[model samples]
Target: MTGLLVKNYGIKKAAKLSGVSEYTLRAWERRYSIIIPFRSESNRRLYSEYDINKLKLLRKLTERGIQISNLSSLSINDLKGLLNRVDSEIISTDEKYLQLYDIASVDKTINDSLEAIKNFNEKKLLLILHRAYKKSNFLEFVENVLFPVMVKIGYQWKSGLLRIAHEHFTSAVIVKFVLKISSEFEIKNKAPKIVITSPDGQHHDFGAIIGDSLAASEGWKSTYLGVSLSAEDIATAVNQTNSHCIFLSIIYPNDNPRMEAQLLELSKSIHDDVVIIAGGNAVTGYKDILTNINAHIVKTPKHFRDTLKSIRNQIRIDKRENYEKKYL
Candidate 1:
């Protein structure tokens, strides 16, 4: 069988098409031995169309639960066999998955929440959260119910079904609940000083608040510097708080070159010892920017927790070294 020949695409174009950074693409090639493209006469990598298509297929399959390591060893024929197995598994479990679909199909509950928010019905919103909090694991309920409902509210706000004021009201209520939960957890050690802020022109901050709350709950002393903070303001907060880490919640992509430039500048201005971490929707398509800024992009709640744990260990080591230098 003849392998499909590919036309080489430049790194930038390939990154845009694959929704993966050129750095990440290069890393995958070097680390995983996947998609080895030929070099051009100018010493640029020329990825074939065939290679691009395969990458797209690979991304899709992996997202659907096909382990990349397993797929990496498979020949084209073997991949087809594996895909068939995946399809069969998906079909076999279709009934179990249908519960999610069914929940999504129920528009009335979502609509009611939107209406209640639009009408400023705080009682209804509080009742909803209160009931969910009591009936389910607080964190699970937040992840499953409140998060989905918030997404719906956002959609409605975007579509003009709900107003910005209404959304703010809903958000304020949720923030209170998150803080309530945070209050329950005790700080173990001198909380590692951390500062949380939103990037400039990005005002959605529920995620930041939640992150700060979780960090605090896990024994990190975090200063929540609400929304619309410029890069300079963030630096100021970092200095004022004597923070070791700065976490920014970005909720949308800033296609503006100025914003990108600010992020780069911000990265350079911060102390080398400080870890800059970014999370939320705004940072989704801009992971490369984070890399450029010497920052880490965290994609999920689990990642956030793990990062805090790692930072805590580093702090412990630093404290021990400082004590030894002073006494021994």
Candidate 2:
């Protein structure tokens, strides 16, 4: 082997130097071919210094909201150029300039996404979402772009400005985009698992799709049981996956007594240790029941994000305690 190929860095060292977890490094390799380390005679992977540096760069960019999918094909020089732009933006202390730059990019994204939806152009809609995803973090993308656009579409559809076909088209496009992005995220096998679904009769599933996508972004292994699932079926899935948490999306048709009973059944069926989170427009109608059952009721998208953070933190604490019990 040439001197340059003297792979001195093992996976742990590479991960340490790159400011990423060993699992994330492996995932990047598998998903994006970001770096394919050499195999030793013993069949163990070994990364060279160059591979370590490249991974470091990728980690920095991805943390700043750039998608790994977009960076996989770029050369080192191209990567550096992008990094330089991010650095420039950070170093500038001029509040006015920063504000304008931020506003322009965000406004453009929202406007373009709305126009694409109005035109019922699925291709353009997906492209716009991709661009937004690249520029903003998942939370920002959902809040500024997805939420606003969906609200506008709903309003127009209800006000007789847009036909039913338009609402259905928009829903399909959004669901497709969310599912595609969720599938792209890689979660460690040992990461906390989550189950996302809407109960039977709650046919509106956009909230459920987005909820699962958000969980996946936080490195949670999410078992997404699509809409219209029975209480027994959801409980079965939770048991099957050994999920740490469950998120239920409750939309219209809020006054159903049967739905209330289903929620109660789910709360009773799942293990007490599992966290239950319920959210959506119709959730308010069952607040008393959810409270009695010790289920979390997220009133808004932002609240849902915050609740997931708490859940992830709890998962970390549980893992640490288990690790101590086993080894320390």
Winner by TM-score:
2
Per-residue alpha-carbon lDDT of model 2 for 263-285, expressed as tens digits? 88987797756778888778877
Q: In terms of TM-score, how similar is model 2 to the real structure?
A: 0.65
Which residues of candidate 2, in runs, are more than 4 Å off?
A: 1-108, 320-328
**Cα deviation in Å at residue 72, candidate 2?**
51
Off by over 4 Å in 1: 1-119, 135-138, 158-165, 324-328
* C-alpha positional error of residue 323 in candidate 2 after TM-score superposition, expressed in Å: 5.5
lDDT of 1 at 144: 55
- Candidate 2: C-alpha lDDT: 0.78
> Which prediction has the highest lDDT against the true structure?
2
Reference-based TM-score of each model: 0.62, 0.65
The sequence of per-residue lDDT tens digits that candidate 1 reaches over residues 44-157 is: 987766676566556546645566666776666666666667656653222332343346447455556656777788888777667666766544555556666776666668
